[model samples]
Structures are given as structure tokens and as C-alpha cells.
Target: MESALAARLAAAPEEGIAPVHFVWIVAKDRASGTPSPMGIWSGDEDLTVTVALPDGTTASRAYLGGLGLEVEGLQYVADLTDNPVTVTLSQIAPAAQALVRGLDVRLAPVEVHATTMTGGALTSAPQLQWVGIVDEGPISTPAAGGAGGIALSIRSEIMTQLGQVNPAKSSDVHQKRRAAGDRFSEYAAVIGERKMQWYKR
Candidate 1:
């Protein structure tokens, strides 16, 4: 099933196309507590989706083009027909298809809020924790003795009571920017390592 989908995605044309993103809107049965897939949609809005790459990189950018949407073994894109520009999961790239198989793939970052710290001088600091993927299990049959693929999971958390600083203040703004730049550098290092791992495979 995944092979067929990969072929379709590889054959698709690239234009005003965007990467496909997914979310698992699990609705629990009020009576039995069973969860089920409800409504699903595709769009180019960055806020609506997020992609978690194997390298621990999370991007809202549509980097997959038309190839990211074609995933196999997922029921989310079985009968989509809203726009011609939209491609089904079975039509995304092979790597993406492999990642999406049986996984609730989302194209948005699961925000984690930082715990606040207070001092005697009434100082407040905001904290942030990036969401991490939770691997469920293998995607293949264990009896067949084949290596099964992993499933990715993500969830969002709110960080409240953040310090809202005035942007016009050069000293304050510079300090914040410097800190953010440092964090981004660290993130880039991790992402680079992940990319190396992916290529090695």
C-alpha cells in the first residue's frame, strides 16, 4: 500500500502546491470512552499544520510541496475532494509516507509553556518546553520478522504569564534577540544531526 502511494506522489507535478499536514482530532465516545476520527481538512495555512521530521525538527513551512500529502495506510485521505490543488496522503513522498503510516502526523508545533520563576525583586521569567514525539510501536507485522516503522505523536501545552516587553527599548530588545538567536543556534545543531541521521539511512 505504501509503495503504491509513493509512486503516485513521485509522479505528481510541482506548482502552487504545498506540503500535506495531518492532525488526529480524536473524539471520545461519551458513553464508552472510545475515540474515533472525526473531520479532517487540508490547507496552506502554516498555523493549521506542523511537520515533525525525524531529525527532531518541527516546521510549519510547506517543504513537502505536493509530495508530502500522499501517505498510505492512513484513513484521513481516502476520499478527499475539496480542491484540485490538494493531494491525498497516498501521493506524498516516500519518506513522508513512511513517517505517516499509522501515525497521527501534525504540521504544527505542540507548544510547551515554561514554568515561571519569581524573585525577591519582582522579577519574572518565562519558560518554554518544545514538544517531543512519542513513538507508539512498529508498523509492520512482527510475525513476518520485518523491521516495523515508528509512529510519531505530539501534543500541545500552554505557557502563560509571559513577560511582554516593549519592542522599542533597544537594551531589552537586544537582550531578548540575543537569547533567541542562541536558542535558534542550538536548535539548528540538533536539526543538523537529525538530517545526517536521515541521510545515513
Candidate 2:
């Protein structure tokens, strides 16, 4: 009975096979002022990586263990781990850091004077405008923005609060992807051997 079940299980098709590798390419986007990873590659022990630098140059190499590659003139580092490879660029790049710093400074709300129009006319009506104030009303608390906006704000705050959170998340995703990829690779190897045996029989 156990043998029969085992045979049935072996014969069953794989349902959902997730990618075994998650690659995080941490680099500055020239257009968008955000840090992001370029690509994630997944595989087992043996893997080939082709790195193309910002300069018109490329290098292809095979890596073992955790691979870290850096070019002298380039401002990025390519890190290849067991599961996914992560490439991180220096946030404080010479040309871009000043712009980034300026943006950071500008993130604070700038006070601007504006004329308020009432009833489609510039009427001098003495009305208390709730500007830059939170109204904690009775019955219920003053609601903030929409669910999506709030959620996004929360996520952004969390990410910003914990700077290394992104790296940690990337690492976790990489591990999961690697495990899945390895399992699939192993299964493929097994199936190939089984087919060979069946053909021989």
C-alpha cells in the first residue's frame, strides 16, 4: 500500500513551482529619484552572472558561495548570495546626492500665502478656516485620508523609519526563492534520471 501511494505521488504533476531565487538590484534610478535593485537571479551552487556597468563595459563570470563584485570607477556593488543576487549602489553619488539632499530638504511642507475665494468672489468674509489643524470631534475621532493613502503612508513611514528594512525583506525573499528553485532543480534531476532508467528498462 505504501509503495503504491509512493508511486502515485511520484507520478503526480507539480502544481505551483515558485522561483527559487529573488534578486534585489539596489541602484539609483537616473530618471526617478529612488533606490532600486536591478535584477535578481536564482539557481543552485553553480551560476553565471553577467554584469553590465553604467560605463559601456560588461563582464561575465561564474561565481561560487556569496559573490561580491565591485568595479573601481563604478559606484555600485553586486552581491550574489545562495538564492538571489543583490546589487546596491551608493546613495550618495557625486552628481545625484546634492539633488537628493535638496529633495529631502523640500519634503517639509513650504508655507505659501494664497488668496481664498468665497462664493466665486473675493469676499472679505471672516470665517475660521481649519488650516493646518486637526479637529478631534466628538462621537468619533477625526478621520485621516483614504484607506489606500493611509496604508501607503504607513508603509512609507515604516520603510523610512527602518532604513535597513528593505535589505532584510530582500534577503528573506531571496532565501525563499532560492529554496524553491533548488527544490525544482533537484526534482528535475530526479525526473531525468527516472526517465533514463525507464528507457533502459
Candidate 3:
């Protein structure tokens, strides 16, 4: 739990604190597959704010677009376990539907924050209750004047990472990216095909 939030819970304030859920998705662009940051929260109005992340660091200020996104099946557990979560975007807005369909959201980083609202505003830093990756995204398009939705299936981040195949390549360029002076892979390509006579007949 976040330090401020834990203290608030311990204090047991008189004022009511409403629970709110916030989601941060690292979505990707359609064409370039470039990363795009989208912040969403279950609130009545949009907000630009920063919050504490689970990695013991402060996140950059995020603009959370509200009133259209929904999160489901989120759980907080004290044990070491991971579960999948689902996120859906209502298809009431055409632009939202288009945006969902246009992006390549596979393996996108997903984070869900749980916090409280006091006096119509967020309390302290929200605690990161769940972390995952986008396993798949399915969009449903409706007919003329019908309502559909875009749903994202999220799975455990550690599980996803375990299943991911390393894309590292054995080449000079790729090796240089890891360490500028490394030349271990310089002759990797040429040595593979080079023939050597090692027998004395």
C-alpha cells in the first residue's frame, strides 16, 4: 500500500473516502506501432495528475480521460499470485471505437491503480493493485445506431514475460546496442560459413 494511503486508513478519518479505479495503458499506434500513453479513471471529469507507481517512484503527470472506460475483475491479494483482468471501453463514441481498432495493443503494458476520493478529488497516491500485459484485444462493431464495445484481455505481467521469446539477435549492430565497445558478435555471421581444414591425412 502507498504510505499516505496506509496512514489515512489507519487514522480512520471522519470524512468519507470513495473508492476509485484508475487505469494506465501503454497502447500502440496503428501504423508505426509506436507507444502511446493513455490514462483513464472512473470519474465524472477528466484530470491531469501524477501518482506513485509500485516501483517506488513517481510517475509522470498523466491526463486521464474519464467517463468512457471501465475496468472489471480486479483483485488485491496479500499472497504471491497473479490473475487476469479485463478492461472495456463502451462504444458510445465512434472516435473511441476507431482508436481502439486502430492500435496494435498486443503485449501493451497495463497498470491499474486503486485509490479513494475525498471531497470530490483524489486523496493521496493510488496504490497499484494490478499489473499485466494486453494478451488480446477484440473489438465489436455494431450496425447502424447500435452499441458495441472494445474489450482488452489482460494477463499476468510475469506470466506474459515468462512466455515471451527473447528477440535478441546475434549481429554486430545488435551487440553494439547492448555495449558500445562490444565486438563479440562482429564475426558471428562470417564465422558460421567459414571452412577450415583441420585434418592431417
Q: Tell me how far the alpha carbon of residue 60 in candidate 2 is from the true structure, in angstroms, after superposition.
A: 0.8
Task: List, residue by residue over 45-95, the lDDT tens digit for candidate 3.
Answer: 667667777686877655456446777888667765656798887765544
Name the regions of candidate 2 deviating beyond 4 angstroms: 1-41, 65-201
Cα shift from native, residue 11, model 2 (Å): 27
> What is the alpha-carbon lDDT of model 2 when measured against the actual structure?
0.27
TM-score of each: 0.19, 0.15, 0.65
Per-residue lDDT of candidate 2, residues 1-201 (tens digit)? 134333433544653222122122233445575753233222224444543333436545442212221111111234421121112223323322332223332222111111122233322211111111111111112346422110000012222344444443334345557575433344443464553544565
> 73 in model 2: Cα distance from truth in Å?
26
Candidate 1's displacement at residue 168, Å, is 46
Alpha-carbon lDDT, every model: 0.32, 0.27, 0.75
For candidate 2, the TM-score is 0.15
lDDT of 1: 0.32
Judge candidate 3 at residue 24 and give its lDDT: 83
Please say which candidate is ahead in lDDT: 1 or 2.
1
